[model samples]
Target: MPDHQQRIAYLLARYADKTCSREELDELFSAIGQGDGPEGLEQLLEEIWQARHPAPEIDYEAVYRQIKPAVPVRKTIPLKRIAIAASLLLLAGTAYWLLPSKRTGKQATVLIQPAQRRILPATNKAVLTLSDGTTVPLDSTGKQLIQQGNVAIRQQNGQLLYASQPTDGNIHYNKLTTPRGGQFRLVLPDGTKVWLNSASMLRYPTTFSGKERVVELDGQGYFEIAANAQQPFKVKVRDMEVLVLGTDFDVMAYGDENSVNTTLLTGSILVKEGSTKQLLQPGQQAVIDNQDHQLTVKTADIRKVTAWKNGMFVFNDMALPAILREVARWYDVDIVYKASPGAELYGGGIGRDLQLADVLALLEGNGFNHFGIEGRKVIVLP
Candidate 1:
């Protein structure tokens, strides 16, 4: 073997064993990108794939290409550039990179059917409730800016932007709400950006003049607060409050959940629940128990926590009910459980843009339960 091929083969082996460091992973991809043909690292991966699965009936590359036709065969492949393509191709069976989920060493597969009912994914649709109680329907189609006093609110390229003139006296507040099966993005008066998930609402002032910029949030929201050392940004969600000078974080405080979760992605935050306060560092999560009023902070998987904002539904050993709750909110459907799959944990990543049928098919393919879709309702069978 050539020296370069030998190095590539060694890197591929290290990758297969999951022992490749960050620098090694980058080098491996760079080397792969510099080379061509399946005679090198590709063959090594094929051997690893075959060794992992004794079934000779399955041809990895063939099946991968069949599932994802858009991914053309490249002699020289860059891992970052071809990551999604590789993930899609590898997600069909064992050794999947873009899997729906797996838990307790079990993988979840979504069975595709020609006749399954398809419910399209949610879109950027919401309603803006002004201070005067006037509700304005918002969608990606609208281009005009709605003016209220000195503030200009507009939906440009699917994002709601707030540009306001200087004001001294009035602090008019408005609410942005996304109903079931909808989502929206907003740029606050302070240039802070917020992405509201389905069945979520954000209440904020038209201008920030006070000592602190405070907002109220219901359901789930991902925020990128504009830096203001003097004026701390605070988010009041249910019984918990997240205070930060400027940070990127995700807050999940749905009323039905037992606890309120605030996951900080960047910067720091002070999470206060009742009298108990907890400080969170970057990549840390604060969980507030609603019943006991206890607060706890722990390390968080930032990717899984912020997946929804990145247009993916990532489940990390998540319960079926919890997953269904998200499906219910995003797809805007009612879930009637005829049989309970107790304590079953799932792990996987599915595209949030997929149709309802596609998601349900994955659950049904597991053979643990059957699902029936009637209108906007989902019936889970034993």
Candidate 2:
């Protein structure tokens, strides 16, 4: 909406175009230095600077323009892309398979055919921060099984599982934390499974505290609460509280975000922020704002909302800056754009198990853009 946001859209559109000149690249770097760039934009500048010069073999700019009109950037993206690549390792550090080689045509084509990707790398992992402020990193490590009170918990593939029965007067408390670049899944003692996104934290009793199961969550999470009419599962996110009588839904309450969204898949929920209260049913979403109690409800698509838990990054009508923020985390890479933000709000796509390069390629398919990756970070330029 703002000029800066529009500029960011344009910058992302031409990020990978190799024909962007040195002066053009410097202009981008200067614009970003003006503090209008995306969150991690600066970190990606070096990578983007690399692409400012032309590549040897092909003219990347020419290729970009050809695809630009075909995939027009819009105010609101129409088709969504599911871009999460499956983990190269399934679980316990087991390598699933190797990426397809660049081999193509002639002798290579005759030698082997490209195999379909089965499962992509799952960007799921979390840490448990004790109430004492000491955080316990929960990865594929930890003993096979750990017992705390009546809870039988274990870690499988970076997910923490709590298998315990409801008991009276349970007092221990624990928090599940998803770090800046990780996500995780867990089944509570009561069978309410939760998928936590990056930079999130979930706090709960080692056992259900009272008749109602209460938990505190920061950032975003998807929940599938076990059906128990007697005991409603309640989640406290920032100023809002979501109470459900056993339902499947997703909650996005990241602190940095202006509004918290609660999307229901099956069943219903009551979301309350301040004096404001909203009801949501299946295929419905409720938005509660932090600044003003502005609330909006509309038809919901749970699939797009819960795609992350299912191992995909689904974006519908998302801006390039918005999309890249998520990408920076999952791919463990940073991004910088060199063109204008008004170029387009990228229509999202699904890249099942796509490599960092492949994922960027799809975005580049819409415009003249090239990416430079060093270590875990990436930069895009035009």
Which candidate comes out best when scored by TM-score? 1
Report every candidate's CA lDDT: 0.74, 0.59
Q: Write the per-residue lDDT of candidate 2 for residues 225-259, one digit (tens) a residue.
A: 98888889999987788999988889888765667
What TM-score would you give candidate 1 relative to the actual structure? 0.78
- TM-score (all chains, Cα) for each model: 0.78, 0.64
Listing every candidate in turn, what is its Cα RMSD in Å to the true structure after a full C-alpha superposition? 6.8, 16.3
Q: Which regions of candidate 2 are displaced past 4 Å? A: 1-122, 132-134, 141-143, 165-170, 368-370, 374-376
lDDT for position 276 in model 1: 86
Q: In terms of TM-score, how similar is model 2 to the real structure?
A: 0.64
